[model samples]
Target: MPENVNYYHITPLVNDLERFFNKYRLLAVESKELGIKLETKDLATFKPFPNKIYVMGSLKLSRNRKAKGILIRKEGKPVLNYSVASLWEFERSPDRIERSKVIVDYTISPKEAIPKEYGNLFTDDFMLWEGFSGMGKGGGRPAVFEGKPLVLPSLIRITPDELEKEFLCRNLGGIWTPKHKASAENRITRLQTFGNTFFPMMSRQYFPISWGSWESFRLEGEKYPALEDAVEPNV
Candidate 1:
């Protein structure tokens, strides 16, 4: 097995229990209405649930106009003429519209962070250094290599505030290359401008396990609780 394949256990916060259950109930009701033949026992076991249909209440319906034309030859004295005509069509319309969208994921893990235990799997090229000891002044060496930080994959269960802070501090540097400095600055500005609203919007929604397929649910406005509230019922 690959060293990076670390299994993560995610638990939702306590406050979100009621809402999660409610959504599950709604899903069950909808499934029944569609005559999908869901097994209660399987659902109760927390098997993968089928993809639930959700209305993007935040998005407005869009209208599209379509037209068709046909070419025909008309009788002429010396040359043939072409005639074009338009076909009848209906006007398109938008559904619902909103300002933002919420993304819910069961698992949230760093795409690039490496786990400490898997240190051997990585080479010097992938390592990041910090905390320079000897530099400038006399003949001094460059920055020294420090131990690698532990990065592991886990379920999404952090508070928005914490995430925002971490995002801001992640790129702070004592000595940075031009590329690193620019990237850090961009991230800092983005977090400062949208940190509060951004983190909550990115919160992932948790659902009951079902034997079926996983489904996503969308709601109008930002009425749902933050992802931090989404906790497993038994937990």
Candidate 2:
């Protein structure tokens, strides 16, 4: 019942620019958990989803090295939701051979209580996760931030990138592309009540989908409802 689990991420930023980021960690505080690292590489080239986050520039961790995936949004959606852990077959799947990283909690990195006096109003780099079973070592009990709770470190790392070309072709709120022209699906029908994986992504020749009853389970589980706990924690 111990497959190395620890995850926690909270970056509430907005102004004060946290000194333009130069290394600010508050993870695990001293080892109760919060040790995330796994970027083994290759998850079928790319195209695996659950919210979404994949890119590489600087978060500190390099093993196989070949990273160049980028996805982020706010007025668009996505806050770090992509999952893989051998779909709960868990013997050890920090995404079990790639898809690993952890480093976030930049003392509330620009989460905005009212800061933005200048730049960084759309994304100064973001990442946060307390899921994918971040509190693994057992189950239930870990979930504390700003008061000191352990178990949190599956992976967290992101900083400084060219992420301002309009956050480049977003895909979290539905129909960012795949050529989604949106003649009038009502913005994909108001983004299907908070994104039901945008329902088969509307047939995806880019877009042409149609839905109704149960939105067809909205991309129903194969391992992505925030990863259903990337499995393996009977600890």
Candidate 3:
């Protein structure tokens, strides 16, 4: 038998994403062999899905927004990419007129820093959060905030130099990168100013499994306890 295999599921709700990532992180810890890919479904269909993940539906955050993402798999112990996991938050604009729409609190897992029996699958690639109805990075998605739209480089490839420069701007909230509307030279200044507060910066650590009742944001859910045993290997 080979070693890796991947399966795909469209995560239409925040709770589902939280649950999947919890499972993904646990499997990584135990060095289990399994693969799962979660693609963000169009926000339009979110309400129909079971389990009202958040009460912000009235906020209309999904009315015109959509997110996208990948594919793969192997056999035996599948070679899963830790990059598949991410933590997102919806920041309410200080003005209340324009919500941040999406804020990626954490993307890289902290465990990757320590030596592990299995190994690490961490990467610096930033998660893509497009706007303008998915037409391009800058458009009217859900709601256009006061500042320039949140955009980043193509997830497919990011140069080493860019990664290094972006790292310098990491802050408390988390991060997203590769500047869309700004020049490479002005990247740091622009990012340090708005990026820190907006996207924050993707941090290295496991995000909380549950988000208590927080009315300011839409991403919230009950705790998804870890599995007692290694998940069944990808069949």
TM-score of each: 0.16, 0.17, 0.22
lDDT of 2: 0.21
* RMSD of candidates 1 onward, in order: 25.1, 20.8, 18.2
**lDDT, model 2, position 211:** 11
lDDT of each: 0.19, 0.21, 0.24
lDDT by residue for model 2 over 100-194, one digit each (tens)? 11222212222112122211111112111222112222122212222443222122222213122212235545333323343322112111111
After superposition, candidate 1 runs with Cα above 4 Å error: 1-100, 105-161, 165-199, 204-208, 212-235
TM-score-better candidate, 2 vs 3: 3
Indicate the TM-score of model 2. Answer: 0.17
Which candidate tops TM-score?
Answer: 3
Ranking by lDDT: 3, 2, 1
| lDDT comparing candidate 1 with the true structure | 0.19
Model 3 alpha-carbon drift over 4 Å, by segment:
1-5, 8-45, 48-51, 55-77, 85-235
Give the CA lDDT, 0 to 100, for residue 16 in model 2. 14
- Ten residues in a row with the worst lDDT in model 1? 209-218
For candidate 3, the C-alpha RMSD (Å) to the true structure equals 18.2
